[model samples]
Target chain A: MSGIVATIIAKYNYWIYICLMMIGLYAMITKRNLIKKIVGMNIFQTAIILFYVSIGAKRGGTIPIIEHAHGGQSHAVEAVHYINPLPHVLMLTAIVVAVATLGVALALAIRIYNRYRTLEEDEILSRIRGS
Target chain B: MKKLGLLLVILSGALLLYATVDFPLWGDPSSPASLHVSPRYIEKTMEETSVPNIVTAVLADYRGFDTMFETTVIFGAGVVCFLLLRVLGGEEGDHYYRHLPTGVTIHVKGAKGKSLSGEFERIDMLWTPYDLVIKTACRIMIPFIQIYALYVIAHGHHSPGGGFQGGVILGASVILLAISQNLRTALRRIGEKTVGILCAIGVFIYAGTGALCLALGRNFLDYAALASVLGTDPVTARSHGILIVETGVGIAVMATMIWIYNNVSSAGRYDEGL
Candidate 1:
């Protein structure tokens, strides 16, 4: 049972992330509320963040920062191995991008609200079609 | 109805699951992404750009053209919003609609002893004491937030920050001001016309800098052309060019975002249809 549990944990982390991602995408696609759609988008973006961060992680790796300057020497001794810093850097930009996209999306939602005075997606569609 | 939808969704999801078999495994060091352009960038970028942050180097130097278009995307969104939702001629009184909240104590400023009638009965409190506190805080924080945003743009070469990150921060601060105060206050501070002009100017600044480099006998975005004026090495010139374009991107993004927010939040108030 313990061996099975370990195997499952090792093999299924990505699957869990994928499941969460699908749930969010499903909500965004099927929900009739604009605000709920935004919430779903947030979840979708957050899952990508999780996927990226998890990729950057290495087993038992230390922080990426270098300690003890080389003091003009060609080579310096170091006891610690550095973790990959690329994904963290990428994630910072991704977070900013996500927020900016969310801002614009929310602004669009507000405009939609003002035009039709309704939050339901189906209602807005029907009204537009009727008009 | 829900169960039917769920079944259809599950069927589609199963199809998607089969598609994932061809994808590279997560964190495979030997994957194509790690093997191709990224490794070259990781090795050569620090020496070429003299910047500690490799991501900034990639964004500002290696793939600067993409950043330019990204800024343009925000500008386009702003233009669309403006066309769709610009408010026209109307006095304050003409647009005001009043309604009372049910089962709540309503406080009237000037109508103390007057009987509740048509206009007075419908008048509810729009600006409350809590709004005042939030407005005051936003006013105090706006300048500092803007300054910090500028710092983030300038220091992006050496640090983890860059144009897009700093631009969004600046835009959010303006949006915060708008939400805490009113649309009028925000417009007064950063008017729509000015934002539109700034958006154009920001794009020009970015594109023009690249053009200048091209005219000076270098590649389109090669910053070595600015070395004569800047009195620095070609490497330093590259960093300076990147910074200039980053500042342009930040300005364009911030102005465009605020403009978009204004238009979207105030839709349908304009009787003059675009």
Candidate 2:
């Protein structure tokens, strides 16, 4: 029981991300407003970003920037000294993609609003059926 | 429909939580992400490129192709926004401008009145009277923002920023100008055609550099090929190449962001919006 508790405590960050992901999922699934759906999508993207960034962390690691003269000279530096950077790099691109997606989604929403004069999913469907 | 969505959401959430149990501990030094290629990148980055910033080196030099395509994605978003919403040659709606001296309101259809081209546009949009304070602050701040953006781009080798970040910052300054003043002011400084062309040119510069390397009898995107031209050794040539391509990315990101913001916020009308 103590070992199980220790394991859970060690991996608690994953639980945080899981909760966040569930919040986003619930919002995206249950929200009737188109804009709310987009907000949920943004939240989902943020959770993914957080999950990836968290993967790069190290308990005793410094920032990825190497300050001393091991600088350009030697490969003596250890991996445990610096946090993983690949995920950080990948997540940067993911962030840009998220922003672009948000912008495009909002633009599309505006176009729909202009045409249908409503943003609620049920109302839009009803209007479409009536038409 | 809602019931189905709820079912899927709950299933996915449960699956995700179940999967998290198999993951590594938080901030563990022995985690797989840290054990793999990241250590190699950290070890070799400064030695190979002399760039102190590992992320910038990896982003601009090691993963140039990724950054190149990433820049294109933003440019495409800008183009897509314009294509979806642009309505051309439309007249401004009915307007009435107050003559300050005579306190007379001259009503005009399609915003065309006597000497309307210059004077009428001054009152074309509504803004709070206290906007002057915000406008003055923005005017004072824009230059510094632009300078800092350049610094971020130029000093990427030493610091934490690179082309995409600097470009976004640069774009935000133009966006600030538009917000404080008007879209017309921004459109005047950088016309639609210019923005379109500049975005394309930014991508072209990155591709062209890679293509230039190919023409010089090296593999595509092999920056070391331009050693003689840059008057540096192979290692330094790669560093210079990274900087050059990073500049391209910056320009592309900046142009694309401004272009997208202009189109999306205005709904392609270049009319009033926040």
The best candidate in terms of DockQ: 2
Per-residue error (Å), model 2, residue A58: 1.4
Off by over 4 Å in 1: A1-13, A45-108, A125-131, B1-8, B15-25, B28-30, B90-132, B268-274
| lDDT per residue as tens, model 2, B240-271 | 99899989989988998888889887888776
Interface C-alpha root-mean-square deviation of candidate 2: 1.6
Number of clashes recorded per candidate = 0, 0
Q: Report clash pairs, candidate 1.
A: none
The global C-alpha lDDT for each of the candidates, from Candidate 1 onward, is: 0.68, 0.82
Q: Write the per-residue lDDT of candidate 1 for residues A1-131, one digit (tens) a residue.
A: 99877655543546666776777777877788998989889887887887677665544444433323223542432212333456665665566566557756776787778789999988999999999
- Model 2: runs farther than 4 Å from truth? A1-9, A69-75, B1-3, B92-106, B110-115, B122-130
